[model samples]
Target: MKNAPTATNSQSTKNNQLEQSQYNTESLTDLSTAAQRARVLHYLQNHRALTTLEARHLLNVMHPAARVMELRDHGYKIITNWRQDSDSAGRLHRVAEYVLMAGGDA
Candidate 1:
């Protein structure tokens, strides 16, 4: 008879994912701290002024605070602003947005 797949197989597969939060911490911090700055002279080049979730998904860094700190320390001026919601004040956990400061180098 053929052997059936086991739960252990599923567990092992999850453990092997490099992009997941656990395995990514150290590796991401290394990569994150390395790509600390880049040229963004135009709208298209901006990193979407990415939201925290987008950062986690795209950058492999779960903690947006850590990534923001690393970027700022490298001389990129991060300007924050409050974007008002249309419906209600309690609609979202975060209302703040960021843009690189004026006169910033590419």
Candidate 2:
């Protein structure tokens, strides 16, 4: 499932194409937080718009609070959007969903 290059001039974009072409997504959803972060961006060069918990669980990251900040310092727009875990139950919210900022794109 490769898309024609999006007209970018960065190796990161190429790397994303390479990774997406070579990964077994069946096992991807189960990676550690840091690993997940690395993997997500690795496969897409998208490094922002991540959720706090998603960043934590998927990447196996211990200090996302700091890491996200650092990444922001470098130029990333992180967003926090929540989804309900269970519908019409009592009231519990699933962690927020994340997407990479366009800037990180190559």
Candidate 3:
């Protein structure tokens, strides 16, 4: 038999995640474009990887690529990898996944 998680375990997990998110929000001042750009970089720095859809869903930004361009302009070497994937409906599309390089001189 497979081990299953109980309801109490799930609630505690959600509470912990909520507390972590609250702490993360304290540093965000406003929802300006520059702030959004910083958030994108911060996420890339912390998570080390991000996709266009993830940025759109999480940061509420329409153009994550533009934010990536701004980061690059500021001397952040972000690498973009194009991936072909199929959506839930079976429609295929190309997506850009970004990663911040360790040494961002280029």
The best candidate in terms of TM-score: 3
Rank order (by lDDT, best first): 3, 2, 1
Local accuracy by lDDT, each model: 0.42, 0.47, 0.68
Compose the digit string of candidate 1's lDDT tens values, residues 1-106: 0232356564333323212433334343454332322211122135546555445445554565554553454344676666653323345555445566665422
How far out, in Å, is residue 75 in model 2? 1.1
Model 2, residue 86: what's the lDDT?
A: 33
List residue ranges in candidate 1 displaced over 4 A: 1-32, 35-45, 82-91
- Model 1's TM-score against the true structure: 0.43
Error of 1 at 34 (Å): 2.8
**What does candidate 3's lDDT look like per residue over 11-97, in tens digits?**
455334433443465344546556667678768878888888778767666789987886675567899999976655777779899
Cα RMSD to the true fold for all candidates = 15.4, 9.2, 16.0
Could you tell me which 10 consecutive residues in candidate 1 have the lowest summed lDDT?
35-44
